[model samples]
Target: MYRMYDVVIVGGGPSGATLARLIDQSKSVLIIEKTDEKSISKLCGGLIAPDAQRMLGKFGLFLPKKVLVDPQMFYVESYDLETKNKQRYQRFYLNINRKDFDNWLLKLVDRNVSISRNTKYLSHEYSGDSITIQIEKNGKRDFVESKILVGADGSQSQVRRKTFNDFRYITKYISIQSEIVGGVILPCYEVYFDRGLTDFYGWTIPKNGTNIIGIALQGKDAREKYERYLKNVLGNNFQEVSRRSTVIIRPRRLNDHKTDKDNRVFLIGEAAGFISPSSAEGLSYAFRSAEALAASINSGKNTGKDYRKRSLRIKFNLFMKNIKSIFMYTKFLRNLIFKLGIRKL
Candidate 1:
């Protein structure tokens, strides 16, 4: 059957949910989520700062205090790539459980939102103006037709596969993260880096009784490096990791002055390269980008051109990428970081 919608978002993560909420115009919306139910295990450490909050606040969403482990500080740890100088940098930021935070945001979205979980996107045929997406679930198949298609899916996004040019991005770093059993975590996001970590860092986020610890490493030696890091972190007495997960983040989205190109499709969040370079964060940016898209559509503006070209967001993103590339490209900036530093300047 052909279920028509004004907008059809392929992933029900933060960006998709936020987009559905932001578009105040009454239009049929469908969210196709591949993750089963409310069990989307988040691979992030869940940290937000003033800039992130400021962005989300524009859409009537901001960090809620109930979910915060610590609502006021971000910790950055630096290890001299050459000399092992352990420096910790602290910046005021809000912290929450990624799983909890995303879930909370989803619940706050308008009740008109209809989301189908565990539904995989099979394929989509674009008529050069509109889109028809085929999805399968529970041994049955259905089709969705929409005026606009949004790829809010993460790094391995299927929507990106359909809309992408033949360009392969700098698919950077490999992360191994999990919830820890017993540890005293500070009230901040601690970042640790050194030659052992190469182009990445290890992190420990506090959540009262438990701790969230992980590292981002690269190359074929990543598994060995991660194991070694865990040993060093736990003093070799730690038992098996509780739940290990991985994610591949882009270094920065370089080619686009504006991220999307087609009128029929748009990209937001990680799929759009909206992940912040300094902290590798996305939820707040996702909300911001989603809101930008909704606002453009509401004001009867052209999304593919007008908002893509004239919006302050696109300019800000390009600006952030330019400044952040320094961190992604070399260890030179690593030398300037203290064990504790601030988020801006």
Candidate 2:
């Protein structure tokens, strides 16, 4: 007899792990993760914003010392590369090693929730009340049945793409990051905005003894622009430790913040387009969406309807973020704000 799980989550990151941790214990759950234990590195700046910190506190969780990195930042230095204007803003962000942070979250998941490491989610088909998913592992294909399928995957989520054929609702960017070991660490996080380089932005974050420089680019010559910025910033005196790249998403419309489809499939975190357009922060959204979905499941209600209702606040927040992005991304407004030292510390 074939066994069926109550829920099967793709991508064992923050959203998947948090859902597994919070879902009803009686319900059988399985998480499919592509990355193995030996090599776990997420392409992220690894900064925990105040919103994420509050969400952690609500979960009664505390960041272990081992997960934290050096140079805890209390300010952000913003620069408009085109205008050559700079300003400092007061903000507190806890720096952390993203891999360690993910590992920590995974460790907190309930033992009853099965985690399949190095497994990739290929596709899924709905039949009757359950969905049959095809997963790949070590050159082998296997099928699993679940009453509900959750796509906690990242921006390039297969589940999301297969479910929602429309891609025009959200904007996507390629984020490239490099860690330099010998660069001088800045006292605070540095943000750069240059329309020539990227419509999004670039940042330099200090972690441990290394400086992490990353940029989000949408069009051609992304690597070239990133390298030029790297050379201009580091001045040929730094050793390149490692380079990482991944897809990042920003919701273009309120409709883009989708939580469910057909009352059987669901999405959370960046997969659902809950990331902040202004700041690109998704940790808080990941945690909150997971909680909302878990609540929906544990309520024993129509999970899809409940999740959609619970996610309205998140969508509203994203809407506000989009409005804020207008101010941040508009060159004239940004330059004026910087020149006037508005909110500067």
Candidate 3:
């Protein structure tokens, strides 16, 4: 007989774990993760906003003391115009070690969640009402039937690759994040702004003497732009300790869930393009999506639109649009000032 579950979640990241924790105890849920007992290594600059904190708190998720408020936020300077004496502004934000925050999120998951590690999904055969999955574990293969499947995998999502064409969207983020043990001494979370980092931002978040300095470039030639920003932030004498590059994806439509076909499998978090297009922040969106997924499942609404309405997708959709529009304005105002000679050329 085929093994069965009400829901089967792939990936044990924040999105998946959060989703599992929120599912009603009455529902039998199973999770498949490829990593070991300790979880896999992740590269990120973990920072949570007020709303994100509140959402996590509601679910009993809390960070360590080290995740304290070091920098509320900061903005270094934006390339408002092509001028010698360009004025730049600063904004402050809190930063935390990526590993610690990730671990904390995993800990908060309710014990009842049956999270299986060192397991992999070979393939899936989808029928009208349910799906059949070929799962691998400890050199053994098993077949499981699940009514609902959630894909919380990151950018390179297998679920997305096999299941949906609609998840495709404009690639807007190109970022380089690094941890430098020795760099120019900076205490605040400073973000340097420029046309390259337009829409996205650059940040120097404190990691206890070491710094997480990087740029989120959304324009053409982002690699060179990102490199230049890294040099400027770290200074010539600075030595590299760590580095990573990432491409961020955003869903096409911001808030309208009218397009969701549902079809048994749900794409949550990065799989669903929940990352804020402007900030490239998705942790909160992931958990919120999980919550929405939970509510939608409880209500017995099986389509994507109903899921979207249940998920915080609508609220976040508005937030994403507003932020994107604001950044566009910032770009526009700067360009207009230079064109009108209001600022130096």
What would the TM-scores of all predictions be? 0.87, 0.96, 0.80
lDDT leader: 2
Total clashing pairs for each candidate: 9, 0, 13
Ranking by lDDT: 2, 1, 3
Deviating ranges (above 4 Å) for candidate 3: 37-40, 66-94, 137-142, 166-168, 196-199, 218-222, 252-262, 301-305, 312-316, 319-323, 326-330, 334-345
Worst 10 residues of 1 by lDDT: 336-345
Cα lDDT tens digits for candidate 3, 282-317 = 777777787888777777665566785666544666
Evaluate residue 289 in candidate 1 and report its C-alpha lDDT on the 0 to 100 scale. Answer: 76
Q: Write the per-residue lDDT of candidate 1 for residues 22-57, one digit (tens) a residue.
A: 876488788888876468566877777666777766
Which is superior by TM-score, 2 or 3? 2
- The candidate, 1 or 3, that scores higher on lDDT is 1
* Best candidate, TM-score: 2
lDDT of 1: 0.70
Residue 301 lDDT in candidate 2: 88
* Global local distance difference test of model 2: 0.89
Residue range 147-239, candidate 2, lDDT tens digits: 999999987788899899656667888899998887665778999899878778999998777789988988777788888878766778899
Could you give me the TM-score of model 2 versus the true structure?
0.96
Candidate 2's C-alpha runs over 4 A off are: 183-185
